[model samples]
Target: MGPFTFISRNSTRIIAGAALLGLVLPGLADALRPFLGYCVLTMLTVSMLRVDVASFFARVRRPLPAICAGLWLVVVFPLTLLCLAVLLGPPFALPLGLTIIFIFVAPPPIVSAPAFAMLMGLDGALVLAVTLIGTVVMPITAPTIASFFVAETMPISAVDLALRLALMISASFALAFLLRRLLGPGRVAAARPVLDTVSVVVAIIFALGAMDGVGARLLTDPGLTLGITVGSFAFALAQMALTYAVFRPFVGVDAVAMGYAAGNRNAGLVVAALGVTQIDDMVWLIFALSQLPIFFFPMILKPLGRRLVAAHSAVPNARSLP
Candidate 1:
């Protein structure tokens, strides 16, 4: 096999390795920070180019479940977190709590999600549908949610936030359509491995950029940084668990897919939308550490995913879509 094939096959390791490198080499983060938005747009463009539009819309036709999942991801999840913050008070009303809310307010990380779903033999189509829906609605939902919970903490005006998100999503979809028109869907589908490799490489660049200033923050206040990092991971796991439990009754392995979507938010989008330089250090740190679980936990969860896939396959008339 060629080098590209090898990298594609070993994407999980590449992702984990890239994330570790980012954590240790804070300088790369600073150097790459300026290009973070470009990287995010590129990754989104490539992933969108590869989307199976027919499959995506077929899932969307079943509007009840798809809308529910989308609402859960973009609206319900963040509101729930806001309620938690309200009930907990004190520290929960602080920057850390706002960071937690920001994570959920962000859309599903579509960059690697569909690829991860395919890798684990889960419902890639459903994952993509939920991701696309969540992303498309982010412009409307994200700013509204942010204003409700973190307006004081946010650096940008609500209108600016909405405009940035809309621009990002629109630009990505436009580029994707142009690419698809030029390359044709068959040609694009044939290059799945290449797309996956490119997505992973861009993700590594993003990971490095997101990690900017994290090391200094750690050095400045090791205890607080460590606490936030741990909390980030815990929040990620909690999202997954809560999503799985809530959606299991509707779909089996598909619930797992939703769980993955719920847990792996596009923090890059939120950061890019907000202007990373304008955000609080604590917010950046939380987003940075959140990447650890998003990239690493897939490897840890692969076995369970495989089992879930196998079990779901055995069920009579089992379908990934509700």
Candidate 2:
């Protein structure tokens, strides 16, 4: 309990430290490699444990904003990227560009997006609600839209892909419900720090495990790997800024929360859904490199998030938020 509470209190340093560990110790990362799947499932379950069910359900009822956000992520943005690729043609580097664009169209936001938002002082319920809304719409929307662009590059049938998403998500949510019932909602609410600590521990393990070959890649292809790393940060930050800008007027302060959700998406979900034993190293590199922002952004943006959340709380007419 003491250690868990300490971890909860100092999660920012701990999480950033985890990223550093992954970069410095490739062997440790490889040892934990097999636990990546369990880490994800734990992240999803722990994320649900802290969410405000009432707020989640309210957003579920009035879901227009979530629907619009999902459309932007999976459909509109991908189409826009496709158009740009067509206009620019050869110099645009279609293969890499396609990989970049595929980030947005991948399943929902990360399972722990809500946890990240809450850690950064944003509204967790809003993020969770919007994310699940995206998930419900993903199976049909993702594969249909990706088919137009990805085609043979993905090499998976639409039906199997959808089923993979369903199974993983269903299992996580079911586990969440069972845990909640066993602990009782009141007890869980009272032990929030422990839950936060669980999220921190799992996230640390995840960051370490996901960086298996990234350090080696850095040694081998320093320039190219560095360039891709830069590109990954650009994609995450640019999408977050763009999403915040587009939705702020309509959703008010809640848009800030939406921006975090929009930018830090779950590209890994696409890999899991593809159901193949292996994929292209380049594609996998892009996906793995992408986790950097997702893991580190809460620490980086903590101050800005504090200001935004403070302003959101102060303004009465902020609209459509708890």
**Leading candidate by lDDT:** 1
Clashes of 2: 0
lDDT by residue (tens digit), candidate 2, 47-118: 766667988887777777777777777667767767777688864537556655664446578877887788
Pairs with steric clashes in candidate 2: none
lDDT, residue 299, model 1: 88
lDDT of each residue in 227-288, candidate 1, tens digit only: 97788788888888899889877776688888877878887887888776776766667778
Give lDDT per model, in order: 0.80, 0.75
Top candidate, metric TM-score: 1
Give the lDDT of residue 170 in candidate 2.
80
